[model samples]
Target: MTPLAIPAHERHGIRVFAAALSPEEMQRDKAGLVAALFGDPDLDPAHVELFDTADLAGVGLAGYLAEGLGVSDAALAPDRARLEAVRGPVLILHSRALHGRAVTLIPDPRLTLLAGYTEERPPVHFEPLPSDAAKGSLTAPGPSAPAPRLPRRALALGAALLLAGLAALVLAWR
Candidate 1:
């Protein structure tokens, strides 16, 4: 397995390996955002354990994270409740491969299910309806400046004056 190496500065001192595993195979049974986070050596291992989407939804991100982060059960009740209230998909690893040795694996999906963790965005992809705005929509908070324009009255007046001047010159030349 080709290990994705993070820079030393990026990860303090621990050796963190993020295995960008495909659906066919995973190096350490880690996938998605969990694998991405686990790739950092500084993160607590017990907290970074496998969490498929169902497991996350069932436990609530607060409860799931509380346990993973080694916090008390009651500590994350609010977080869990918030996740339960939302209908949208939560960030989680889709599936985790069986663990082997120390390296952790994460899946490379058909499209990115998570963002905002990094400065860069995932590559663009095409999606059908309930259309994904990020992929195709041109709508944006209007541009920093308005579109340039020439007033219709001004343009018409300028053209008329130029034509009048040309006509005068032609008459004088004659």
Candidate 2:
């Protein structure tokens, strides 16, 4: 299994959102992994969003790849299982490249696990994606996805009105 090579054109929008799964877990979790890459494999690539990795954050098979690796650095080692795990969920956004062709990665010593295929990259900031099904209250909201502010004054007024109504009822009963 070769290291999964994201093509030159496709790498820009490829961001692993740092919410439900940590940056560490995103490299490994199955649901988070699959959702981030292939995007609900049932759908075609054009309409599919590339990095919505939050969907499978808490699945039963989520951490199968990360299992037994032990420590973050050790998980970074490039191997057959690592390559297989990486390739399994990744989608080919461009075409239906047929089987039996050997895929080659342009070997660069500088490339690390987080290092993407491209050189000049757009800012991949921590923007909170809307994932009520995924993070819920477990993680902090991303910059783009702020949590809804509570309507404090409305609640207070409602409570006050209820109390007044109760008092009037008590007086009428007396």
Best by TM-score: 1
* Consecutive 10-residue window with the lowest summed lDDT within model 2: 91-100
Q: After superposition on all CA atoms, what RMSD does each candidate show versus the true structure?
A: 18.7, 21.9
Q: Cα lDDT for residue 160, model 2?
A: 100
Q: What is the C-alpha lDDT profile of model 2 across 34-97, one tens digit per residue? A: 4443333332334222233233355211132234211132433444233333322222122122
Total clashing pairs for each candidate: 4, 2
Question: What is candidate 1's lDDT per residue for 59-91, written digit by digit as tens?
Answer: 654554445433344543444454444342333
Each model's lDDT: 0.41, 0.36
Q: What is the lDDT of candidate 2?
A: 0.36
Error of 1 at 154 (Å): 99
Clashing pairs in 2: 30-62, 128-142
How many clashes (backbone atoms < 3 Å, residues ≥3 apart in a chain or on different chains) does model 2 have? Answer: 2
